[model samples]
Target: MKTELLEFENKHKLLEPTSTERVATLEAISEYTENFLGNIDTLPAFVNNVSEKAPFIQSINFEEQNTLNEVLKNIRLYIDTPGINPASGGHLGYIPGGGLFYGAVGDYLACITNRYAGVRFASPGAVLLEETVLNWMANLFGYSKNYGGTLTSGGSIANLTAIATARDAINLKAKDYHKAVIYTTQYAHHCLQKSIRILGMDDVQWREIECNNLYQMNVEELEKAINKDLNNGFLPWLLVASAGTTDVGAIDPLQQLSEISKKYNLWFHVDAAYGGFFILTNKGKQLLKGIEQADSIVADPHKGLFIPYGLGAVLIKNKKLLHKTHQYLANYMQDASTEKVDLSPADLSPELSRHFRALRLWLPLKIHGEKPFENYLNEKMQLATYCYQQLSNLPDVEVFNKPELSVFAFRFLHKELPLDKYNEKIQKAVMNDGRVFISSTRLNNCYVLRIAILSFRTHLSTIETALTVLDKSKKIAEDELYQELRNN
Candidate 1:
């Protein structure tokens, strides 16, 4: 038995590499990353013609030990090469997440230390670090010192936490789920609906308030809907507004919506996952004026602050309600039950074994300061305006709403081909060209292209390149349509 124990221990020691081995591994990883970053400017944002059964899929085997070089080779070829290169500056699709180098370094240090930040007794310093970051966000959004929040994996979970807290604040019971009424525009992020389902409140009455041509919710219609619900004996419980919507960057009439929510006695929650951090800029502050009045707000650092993905925050004005919703106790966690100056993240969020996510945001803010992030966000808004102007100038293009933040939709027109079909062809051509990536969404049942400019790496030059690509793709799509017509 002693000999067997010694053999097992020796085998386990392999998991902790020697100092020399660690250095070599780090060097190799550094070299690969440096090369990738060096050519990032020239890399295609989208890679077409990906194989259905790539080599990486076949290489997945855990029975055999592989060299570090071989592992990186597989990652390069199979993981990073075949799809949208999110790290590329040309990534102008859906909401773009920033991949800051300093954030990655912070993640490395956090993983190496492996601090359990969920409980204060386990790691008081780690807990304080997270609390400090959340407090900073709360203050930025104009919350009082009584505010509380927790860092989540991303906006989805953060929004879920907000919804759960709102539900419990009223002591809503399962039997009354059918009577609860929630209000939001059609453009509200789908995560809210998912949250309702997850919380077993799917039967709650949902009123999609009408929006104006600019996509801002129509305040008069919203009030009418609320009154209708009230007359019908339905409880108006929550109002979810957008600071920046995903599709067109539309900001609902926030100040008006807040006023209505207050008057109607409904909880006002703002989903600013894509545009929350914009509050750092002067224009953003003016645009998001009424956001400070929200009962709770969901924001993503990865989106506005240009940090790498996986960092989101939720701020609730009433700290006690947040704690009441998510707090739990178990016998095994008795050691962590001691009272402390700060509330544990585990008490305010559903997660218990969460990653040390605060380090990523903290390191970047400390190293680069807040000025650069503000500048980048302001730059993105300007770039979006520039792109909108350029697209509107084209003879055959129809521009949609002017960007409220840094996103808008547009579509190309062709005389011979159906409008939707022609725009679809144009979208395909641009993606196949692979110089820059763009996405599409349907508005009023018409296909339209979308550009979301939020990546810290994106600049005026990148937007110009996208314009050039659009021109080339337009010609290609036209020729293809003509050829198909002739063939028929």
Candidate 2:
């Protein structure tokens, strides 16, 4: 053997840090962790706006080493420091944006270990851990033995993957996917349209469902459209239902939709990214009654489970369908020595190198247990109802749809101003004040304000603060509206 080869083997003999250094490193990390977790309520004050006041940018500098103690002190300071929030202006408003204790630790350990969970043959242990989490998610939605799925980065990718699976399953028997159609509400998230575009099926018919007064997809409209499509020689490939809509927390009429899917032989998929995990709670389970009948589901632990983002899963009722659609062989990546090499993740997702994302969820569930997560979700449900009650009492505020889950949409009903003008003024006022962050949308050609109670930190007090701010904005907006009327 070459001397260089011998040197490489000798140098690869594990690079573990010394115990004395490890102890010091752990202590430093502990101190930083304490600081990070302690000050959750410390809201930031608006500092200099970068666009208004140009801030200095630092360039690459000379390398320097600090003592571990010094490094820890600086890290503590860095963790505590708050920068201008780009999402909500400079004011120090934050959503519960929860910090899961165990998940963080798991992420740190996974990073240190550098585990690749892409293939069963390369790392069976890592792959098994991920598969276990996927199985757990499948069971959560009442998926049976025939169902299986894969984890993705977030709800968008999960939706994309589910659509891809639907495409593959339908296209297996048919030649022209261009004639295939998808059904979803106009209020459905734009991610669905983006996914269709990505799949090179942009020209395919997208049936925009008509919503009732409550913002739910009208099941009758869906049936009518399905029949019309069939008569016109269009293939109804999928029916996408919303478990919890992004705008106003509107849940589509799932039971009726399920029946329609069964009658029409359409692939039924539920986008439960915001409300799926809440299936653990009584109210949530009740709200999502027909979700169990779905052929596929998209759920985000990041949003509903209160974990940090980068965790989403797609559960399909037919596991073999996923394998049938995505399985492909690569000779170089496979080991020929073993007669059977088990399944690889490359056989599932488009990615060849999957990260150890499962540990983030597994660690949290293991350490804190399921009871706490269930309780947390149940609390959010109550909070959303409380928000509705609070807004109902406000003078000019009109509650749009009573929360189907932890999301609600509403708008101000002004007697003297048109709906659009009043809503525009109100949105501007609330956003400019920077007291609370809320989003707005157009439902039925009318502007509607949307508040989704997603943050675990949101409480009755948060809702109360938002209402008080909304009251102030309403008065200001009313005055502005009257002034405009007078001026005109």
**Candidate No. with top lDDT:** 1
For candidate 2, list the clashing residue pairs, or say none. 44-92
lDDT of 2 by residue, 181-209 (tens): 88999878889999988988777778898
lDDT of 2 at 446: 81
lDDT of 1 by residue, 310-394 (tens): 9989999999999999888788977776673467988888989889999999999999998998998999999999999999988
Off by over 4 Å in 1: 56-60
- Measured with C-alpha atoms, the lDDT of residue 76 in candidate 1 is 85
Instruction: Report the lDDT of model 1 for residue 359.
Output: 96
How many steric clashes between backbone atoms does each model show? 0, 1
Q: Write down the worst ten-residue block by lDDT for model 2.
A: 86-95
